[model samples]
Target: MNSVVELRHLTKVYKSMIALNDVSLSIEQDSIYGLLGRNGAGKTTLMSILTAQNFATSGEVEVFGENPYENARVLKRMCFVRESQKYPEDSKAKHAFANARRFFPHWDQVFAEELIEEFRLPLNTTVKKLSRGQQSAIGVIIGLASRAEITFFDEPYLGFDAVARQTFYDRLIADYAEHPRTVVLSSHLIDEVADLIENVIVIDRGSIIIDDSAEEVRKRAVNIVGDADAIARLVAGREVIHRESLGRVASVTMLGRLSSVDHEYIADANLDLAPVSLQQLIVRTTQEGPVDPSAAATEVRSVQT
Candidate 1:
């Protein structure tokens, strides 16, 4: 597949803090990409740079094989739906649709209208007067109906309930099947989108920690459960990601798949194997080091404050 977006040694600094650090990534064309991390992990910063909404502090970024900043040709084919999308105070849903139609070459007014009805957004209500979920619905409608070659959805379902969120996903998948394009979806809800994403790119502490096919990453680890003593023996000397014990049973997740030798050992130990959830792997991979004893009391106090 061709690369639709590329970043090399990308860095973003905010005065005294680093937002992105030497991060490099290549996004394949016509693929559904997931940019996942915690709130402060720089996902928004990277998307802003890719869409030319923000200038990178250093390094290079290319969209559609060209620099995106001020390049109308490249910009015209992209749509960015962010969490904080804003509109004029007096503008209504109808006005937003009208503006979107004027801007996007491939805008589908019919689909937009359908989405408005599906989301139950009041067309005559002022944009500012709409509920948060309605605001998010506006963004989702534009992102889906615009038919941009590359669309970026940065936490665009913030206030959507489960039913509405599922509706968005269903529509997105159906639309994507009919019109294949590069899509980057950034969200903290990992498991919710695990099936929709073709590839996973994890950013932790401003750097790429996990970049691989979702299938490959899923296969890189496995969970084992059985008697506590047998589980410990089976997972001994391995890279344990997570472990939990209840009564005499213990479940453990360890990095790397089971080799033939390891499988034989597990068989001998009589432990049952289970699949690990993507969310669990992400949490374990990104967790910080052990807590400091001196700061433990201080941390508790800070939480209460």
Candidate 2:
């Protein structure tokens, strides 16, 4: 697959802290990428640099094979829908959409109108007066209607209810099918977007922990359930990510594929195997010490949207 965006040795720093450390990755064209990570995991910083909203401390970034900084040619081909988007104090939702139409050359007014009705957004109300969920809907509408070559949605469903979020997801899938493009979505709700993302990138503590296809990532770990002693012996040499015990029964999540011998042992021990979901796998992979209390604050101050 052709890469629409490339990051080479990308790094970001805030005073004494490193937000992104020697990161290198590629965003393939015409696919949905899930940027899964906890707060202060550099997801926003990476997106900010790609969109030219923020500059990398060091290293290189290429969007559509060219530097995105101050480059209208590249910038116009990408859209960054963020929760912190700002609007004129007096401007209504209509004004925002109209402005978006002007900025996004491929903007579809018809689609925007359809989304407005579907989201039941109030066009007359000033953006500041609208509810948080309603405000988020504005960004979602622009993201879908803009139809940019590479769109970045950074936690776009901030305050949305389950139904509203599902609507966004359903529309995203439907529209993406009819019009394929590169989409980089950053969200904390990992499970909710699991089915939507074709590729998964897990960032942890300023580093890339897992970068692979969703299907492959799902297969990276397996959960074994049975007698505590059997599970302990089976997983003795394996990398255990998570474990649970209930009296004599133990459930353990371990990395790497099971071999024929291991399978036979599991069968002999009457053990059961369960598939790991994307969310659970990610949680276990990134589970560690508490994040720096100042990391989130620094990112908030440094990141531009």
The RMSD of every model to the true structure, in order and in angstroms, is 8.2, 8.3
Cα lDDT of model 2 by residue, 1-305, tens digit: 89999999999999999999999999899999999888988899889999999999999999999999999999999999987788888989999999999999999999999999999999999999999999999999999999999999999888899999999999999999999999989988988999999998888978887778888777777898999998888877556778999999999987777767777788888999999998888888778533232221121111111
Q: Give the lDDT of residue 107 in candidate 2.
A: 99
Q: Whole-model lDDT, candidate 1?
A: 0.85
Q: Give each model's whole-structure lDDT.
A: 0.85, 0.87
List runs of model 1 lying over 4 Å from the truth: 246-248, 288-305
Q: Mind giving the per-residue lDDT tens digits that candidate 1 earns over 1-305?
A: 99998999999999998999998889999989888887799899999999899999999999989999999999989999999688987999889888889989999989998898899989999989889999999999999999999999999999999999999999999999998998899988899999999998888878887788888777766888889987776666656768899999998877766667666767777888988787877877778422221221121111010
**Candidate 2 lDDT score at position 200:** 89
